[model samples]
Target: MDVFPLPLARIGIIGGGQLGRMMAKAAKRLGCTCVVLDPTPGSPASQVAGHQILGDYHDPSKLRELAEICDVITFDIEDIDTETLAQLEQEGHRFHPSPRVLALIQDKLTQKQAFAAAGIPTAPFVELSEPSPEAFAAFGYPLVQKARRGGYDGRGVSIVKTPEDYDAHLPVPSLLERFVPAAKELAVVVARARDGECRCYPVVEMCFRSGENVLDLLLAPANIPSSVAEAAVDLAVRTVEMLDGVGIFGVELFLTETGELLVNEVAPRTHNSGHHTIEANVTDQFEQHLRAVVGLPLGVTDQLSPAAMINLLGAPGRRGRPIIKGMAEALAIPGVCLHLYGKATSAPFRKMGHVTVLDPDIETAKRKAERVRDLIEISAEDHP
Candidate 1:
């Protein structure tokens, strides 16, 4: 397979967050220059990339400049201006997943609609423009309210248990969904080559933080019936193939109490769920994304060991530069790896880093992951 002739190939990434940072590392391994564009100076990805373009992501001029210099352009974040990307693509700039794909998914309502159109089963949903009691009645109690656009990592989403809950928050253009009483939240990471080759990792079970939708821990090879695991993977793969895009896709799923699986959402780039792949799989998601987007052969998705991952979130009430505590105790555990995103500041619930614990069995990995989570403290400290 002829990838864009090695050392000459340059990749441009739209958002320079942790995902982009990891992708840049993978590009470096392949001897490709990664150019990151974001407003923040010395952002996570920009710090590691070959070069940085400091500008707003939605600025057409910056977009054009990025496209002009890179052989392939991709995004670390889902939110982007598709119109500018489309215009650039028309002028022969290459986007791995294509701006058209972004146009279809940039909004929550549109994304859910696409799932239905593709014959993928998802939770029942309705569009909303106002936060009203009647509107909540339409979807019924204990529903989910998700902003139609621009929400991530437990923000812009709320569980409305009562009609009063609707009145409590201001409304934007959003979608309300009948909450699925899922027994388990599942995720699968799949990579598709430009030539249509597809590969997927094993299903993972997600545990969310209480009172928040953020994932706290991920257990790979979810301790479920093999048949259920197969079904989850099949559903995830189908979702990616329907989108028909290069690069890696993370498919979030819900396993219901009655033994049915439903698609929760699809992230069109490398995801938090796949962080364990860095230590547990033959090829990590970042490298797999680089390989696929650049037209290299898809790598093996086989797991090297059972792994569990826990996200490192910033400690509440500490609002300044990040000061990590308990690193020595966390690392002293056997088969543990930590990854810190070089962010200068910290806030409540912000993702600062993640740790992956590997073990001979999934249960052991999960137990170790819990200890790692408690041992490491991402406390916000006064900048010195």
Candidate 2:
């Protein structure tokens, strides 16, 4: 096997969220610098990055400055204006996963169609300019209406169970999708290099709370039939091939009651489900993403142990700086790792941090994970 040299001294990240913060930390470990561009002065990534560029995504001058300073650019969020990025790319800026890939995945309608065109199976869906009663009738009731652009973490997504429910929330441009009756939700994280080399991590089974997926409890190396796991990985690889996707691609899937797997969605970067890989895999997703984007050799995706991840969300009816009421109790659990994103304010349904637990057996890991999750509680109160 031929070894590839690392890129330049510094890499630029377009978002200053927790994902970017973690990526910056990984880069620093490799003796590389990470420069983050975000409008917020106190953004999570900015706190850890070697340098920070405070500007809006639409500011071309700032983009050009970032392009001049860093070897390659990648994004932690897809909400950035791709048109501007495309212009920068033409002017000698190099972007990972490419602006074209970001453009396609930013819009839910285009993303779903891309899956079908790639010969990937996904739930039936129809695009809508206005989610009216008649439009809802076409897709049938108990369907999901999601904004084509700028939706994440259960926001801008709603279920229309009946005609009355549809009438209540009208005048929104969204996509109506058939809600697949799923037995389990699974996800696979795949990383692909610019040279087309790719590797997939072990599959993860996900559980949602209260019809909203804000809180995730992930079971790694999902205890599914071997055939099912293989199929999931195959689908993920195919999707990456179709997009010519670079860096980490997270393929969210639905395992139906009929033993069929359907692609739910694709996130073009590191994802929350892959968070367990940080402790359980030979190489974590952040490093893999860096390697892929910089044209380096991909890392091993083999699992070292069974793991589970629980997301901590802020409790409702409370406001201000967040506090984990039972942090010491949760941290006391053996083999439990907690990661808190440094955010000053907390609101209902906001993702504050995550907890990961590992064990030799999947069930035991899940039990320990639940215990840790139960012990910790996030309240929107000022923490002295």
CA RMSD of all predictions:
1.4, 2.0
Best of the candidates, lDDT: 1
lDDT of 2 by residue, 1-384 (tens): 754355345789998888998898878776668889998888888888858999987688887788898989998998888888898899888999899999999999999999888778999998899766777887798888888887889877887788888654535677889988899999999999999998999899999887665746999988899999999999889988999878999999999999999999999999998988888999999988998887777999999989989998888777688877889988888889999989777877788889889888889989988888778888876666
RMSD of 1: 1.4
Highest TM-score against the true fold, candidate: 1
Residue pairs clashing, model 1? none
Tens digits of per-residue lDDT for model 1, 63-141: 9999998999999998898999999999999998889878777788999998999999999998888767777887798
**Where does candidate 2 stray beyond 4 Å?**
1-8, 167-170, 382-384
| Pairs of residues clashing in candidate 2 | none
